[model samples]
Target: MIYIVLSIFCSVTVAMLLKLAKRYQISIIQAVTINYLTVIVLSLLFFKPDFKVINSSAPWPIYIVLSVLLPTIFLFLAASVKHLGIVKTDIAQRLSLFIPILAAYFIFKEDFNQLKFIGLGIAFLAIILTFLRKTEAQSKSNKWLYPIMVFIGFGVIDILFKQIALHKELPYTTSLFVVFCLSFLVSIIIVATMVIRKKTKIQLVNVGCGLILGVFNFGNILFYLKAHKALASNPSTVFASMNLGVIVVGTLIGIIVFKEKLSKLNYLGIALAVCAVILITLSQLNAV
Candidate 1:
C-alpha cells in the first residue's frame, strides 16, 4: 500500500513538474532528454543491469520503437498538461489502460466479460465529457489535440512495453536500461535538431528541471515495480490502486492547488472515469 501510494504521488508529481516548467521558462525537450540521462544513471546505480545478456536476437525492434516513443510521448505529455491541465491529461493517461485491454480482446483474443464491456462504454463517455471545454472560444483553439495525442501515444507505448515484457529471454530491468539509453540517444537527436534550427535554447534551468522530473519519473516506475513485488499475490489491487489513485489524487491537486475550472459535465466525466476503472478491475478479478 505504501509503495502504491508513493507510486501515485510520483506519477502526479511528474505532471505537476511539467505544469511548473513553463512558468520557469524550462525547455521541455531538453529537460526530457536530460530526464532520460537521469534514468540511465539511476538504472545503472540501482538495477546494475547486466549488459552481457543482451544479444543480437533480442527484440531490437521493440527496443527501438520504445526508444523513440518514450521521449516523444513525454513531450506530448508536457503539452497536454500545458494545454489541457492535469485533470484531463491524467485521466486520459489512466484511461489508456483500455488500449491494452482492447488489444487483449482483438489481437490476443482474450475474452471480455460483461463488466469490461460496460466499463469501456463508460470510459468512452468519460473521455468525451472530460475534454469538453466550457467555452466556444476555448473549443475553437483545438488545444484538445494535445490530450488526444496523449491518449493515442500512451496507448501505443503501453502496447509496446507489453510486447517487451513478453520476451522472457531478457530481464525487464536490462531491457529498461537499453530502452532508456536508446531514448537518450533519440532525444539528443531531437534536441540537437531543434538547437540547430534555433527553435529552442539549452539552459541550466532545463537540466535542473529534468533532474527533478527524472527522479519523479523514475520513482513512478520504481515504486510501481516495488508495489507489484510487495503485492505479488494481489496484482489486481496494485493495478486498481495505481490507476484510481492517480485519477483521484491528480484531480484534487489540479482543482485545489491549480484552481483548474471544470464544468459540471466534466465533473460527471471524472466520476464516470472512477466507476469505469472499478468496473474494469472487477472484470479482471472475475476473469481470474
Candidate 2:
C-alpha cells in the first residue's frame, strides 16, 4: 500500500514537473536528456545491476527498443501536457492499459471474459468522451495529435515492460538499468545532433529541471515495480490504483492549480474512466 501511494505520488510529480517546465520556458528535449542521465546514475547506484548476465541470448531487442521508445514517448508526454493540458494527457496515458490487455488476449491467447469485454467497451467510450470538445474552435486549436501519440507510445512502452517483467533470465532491475543506459546514450546522440544543427542551446535551468524530473520519473518506475512485487498476485490492483490515482490527482492539479478548464462532457468522461477502471479491475479479480 505504501508502495502504491508512493508510485502515484511520483507519477503526479512527474506531470507537475513537466507542467512547470512549460511555464518556465524550459527546453523539454534538453531536460529529458538530462533526466535520462540522472535515471542512469540513480538506477546504477540503487540497483547495482549486474551487466555480465547479459548475453547474446538475452532480451537485447526489447532492451534496445525500450531504450528508444521510453525517451521518445517522454518527449510526446511533454508535448501532450504542453498542448492538451494535464487533465487530458493524464487520462490518455492511463488509458494505455487497454493496449496490454488487448495484447494479452490476442497474442498471449489469454481468456477474455464478459466482464473484460464490458470493461473494454466502457474504456473505449471513455476515451471518446474524454477527447470530445465543447466547441469546434477549441477542438481545432487543441490538436489531438500529441495526446494520441502519447496514448499509443505509452501503450507500446507498457507492452515492452511487460515482456521484460516476464523474462526470468534477468532481474527486472538489471533489465531496467540496461534500458536506461541505452536511453541515455540515445539522448546523448540527440542532444549532440541538436547542438550541431544549432537548434537549441543547453542551459543550467534545463539541467536543473531534468534532475528533478529524473528523480520523480525514476521514483515512479521504482515504486511501481515495487508495488507489483509486493502484490505479485494482484497486478490488477496496482494497475487500477495507479491509473485511477493519476487521473483523479492530475485532473485536480490541472483544474485547481493550473486553472485549466474542462467541459461537462469532459467531467463525465473522467467519471467514466473511473468506472472503466473498476470494471477492468473486477474482471481481473474474477479471473483470479
Candidate 3:
C-alpha cells in the first residue's frame, strides 16, 4: 500500500513539476530529456538492477518495444499538453488503462468477476467526470482524436511492461534501466529532429530541470516496478491504483494546493476512478 501511494505521489509530483517548468519558460523536449537522463543516472548509481533477466530471447519483445515506444509517447504527451490543458489531456489519457486490462485477461489469462466489472466502469466514469469541463475554453479545446492516438501508444507500453515483469527474470530495475536507456537513445533522435527543424534549443534551464525530473521519474518507475513485482499476478491493478491514486492526490493538490475547483461531475469522476480501482484490483486478483 505504501509502495502504491508513494509511486502515485511521485507520479503526481512529476506532473506538478512539469507544470511548474512551463512557468520557468522551459522547452518541453529539453525538460523531458533532462528528466530521462536524471532517471538514467539514478538507476545506474543507486538501484543496481541485475539486467541479465532481460538478456534472454524471451525478454526481446518487451525490451525492443518500450525501447522504441516511450520516447514517442512522451513527445506525444507533451504535444497533448500543449494543445490541451493538463487536466483534460491527462483525464483523456486515462483511456490508456483499457488495453492493459483487456490484454492481461486475454494474453496473461487474468481472471475476474461482476464486481470487478462494476468497479472498472465506475473508475473510468470518475476519470471522465474529472475532466468534465466547467469553462467554454476547456470544452472547446477537448480534442478526442489526439488523445486517442496517445492512448493507444501508452496502452502498448503498459502491455510491454506487464510482459517484461511477468516473463523476464531481471530485477524490475534492470528492465526499467533498459527501457530508460532505450528511451534516452530514441529521445536523442527526437531531439535531433527538433534541432534539424530548428524548432527549439536546449537551454541550461532545460538541462537543470530535466535532471531533477529525471531523478524523480526514475524513482517513480522503480517504486512502481517493485510494487508490481509484489502484486505480480495483478499488476495492471496496481497500475490503475497508482494512477487513480495520483488522481486522488492530484485532485487534492488541485483543490487545496492550487485552489482548483471541482464541479459536481468532476467530484463524481474522482469517485469513479477510486471505485474502479477497487473493483479492478479485487476482481482481477480476488486478493484485496
List TM-scores for all candidates, in order: 0.98, 0.96, 0.82
State, as a TM-score between 0 and 1, how close model 3 is to the true structure. 0.82
> How many backbone clashes are present in model 2?
0
Give per-residue CA lDDT, model 2, range 107-165, as digits (tens): 99999989989988888888889988778887786478888888899888989998988
Give the C-alpha miss distance for residue 170 in model 2, angstroms. Answer: 0.7
Off by over 4 Å in 2: none
Candidate 1: give the clashing pairs.
none
Write one digit per residue (lDDT tens) for candidate 3, span 1-288.
Answer: 678877877777766675576578888777777677777888888788675555555576677778788766776766655454455445545556767877866887866578766765775676567666778876776464555567688888878886776754566667778778878887878888898899987689888888877867776777787798788877766866876777567666656765556688877766676666666656755645
Greater-TM-score candidate between 1 and 3: 1
lDDT-better candidate, 1 vs 3: 1
Name the candidate, 1 or 2, with the larger TM-score value.
Answer: 1
Q: In lDDT terms, which candidate is top?
A: 1
Specify the highest-TM-score model's number: 1
Number of colliding residue pairs in each model: 0, 0, 8
lDDT of 1: 0.93
Residue 191 C-alpha lDDT in model 3: 84
lDDT of 2 at 230: 98
Summing lDDT over every window of 10 consecutive residues in candidate 2, give the lowest-scoring window.
Answer: 134-143
lDDT of 1 by residue, 1-288 (tens): 999999999999999999998899899999999999999999999888989989998899999999998898899999999988999999999998878889999999999899999999999999999999888899898788888888888998999988988888888999999999999999999999999999998899999999999999999999999999999988989999999999999999999999999999999999999999999999989999
